[model samples]
Target: MRLGIIIGSVRDGRFGEGVAQWFIPLAQESAAAAGDEVSIEVIDLKDFDLPVLTSATVPGAANKQYVDERVQRWSAAIDACDGFVFITPEYNHGVPGGFKNAFDSLGSEWAEKPVAFVSYGAEKGIRSVEHWRAIVSNFHMVDVRTQLAFSVFEDVDEQGSVAPTDSHADRARALVGDLISITGRLVTTR
Candidate 1:
């Protein structure tokens, strides 16, 4: 399965990149254990030049006309992926605006895909992810049960490196295993 690991934060000094770096190898190992072919791609929201919803076309609209080439490329990337792992940071108890807009920019590309979360914040970013879960469910995305949440104060270092507790490895393994299992099942059905 083609898995897109989305970096959900785009601000200066964000810790998402380090988390994603830590996640890729675990995801790969989990897929290998299951005898599944997994290609992991890191999708950074900062790389996309997405404008806030100024286009007349909404994402789920029929015959959607994208505002520009960047949006098209973003949609294409999402369409190519079978599942996703979103690494997010809790900001003011919500997801970053850019991450939300990225989701709003495209529609059916996310439909029927399994989405998991690896979030960090003062207390594991659970509030932000709770909102995200509700939103993605509206898009018909399958929520992987094993979510990896880290407390920024505890899991990240001053150098902006991810230094998760030893127990987090087991949680990450569970998250990846669930992602592989759910995505594999969905792939067979598709």
Candidate 2:
């Protein structure tokens, strides 16, 4: 299973990246022990030039400012991956604008792909992910039920990494394993 861990926030000091850094390896290791090769890709929005989305410049527009060639590349990457792990932080009670733009630029590429969430915020980030789930559903992607939510004030250290805890680590690993199992069946059941 090829799982793309999409960093869903683009702020300079955003905590989502730190969470993904801690979350991905644990999941990949679990899949490896099951004798299934799972490929993990981290999709960071900062690396791309995706700007404010505009309809005149969104779908077929050649405008590289609001919409760029990189959007197309990002969409292609989604198509190549089998599933996703959206590492999102709650921003103003919803996902950040950049992440929404990144997701909005793509169509058809997200279809039939399984998705999961690892949300972090002051209140465990469920509010942000609730919006994300509905949005991914519009793209026809299957949103997995398991989640690993950490709080901004309590779940991390001064270095901005999740304070290594055994219980959360175990749950994180199991979440990935479950996603792999269910997604594997979903992809092949046809």
Clashes of each: 0, 0
lDDT of 2: 0.79
Local accuracy of candidate 1 as per-residue lDDT tens digits, 35-83: 7477778888889877787787678883445868888888888999999
**Model 1: clashing residue pairs?**
none
Best-performing candidate as measured by lDDT: 1
Q: Candidate 2: which stretches are off by over 4 Å?
A: 57-67
Per-residue lDDT tens digits for candidate 2, residues 1-190, read: 7888888878888787778778878877876777756777778777776767665644423332323577767867777788888888888999878888888776767777889898999888899989999988885788888888898888888866778467889889878877888778877762
Task: Score candidate 1 by TM-score against the native.
Answer: 0.93
Angstrom error of the Cα, residue 85, model 1: value is 0.5
lDDT of each: 0.85, 0.79
Every model's TM-score? 0.93, 0.88
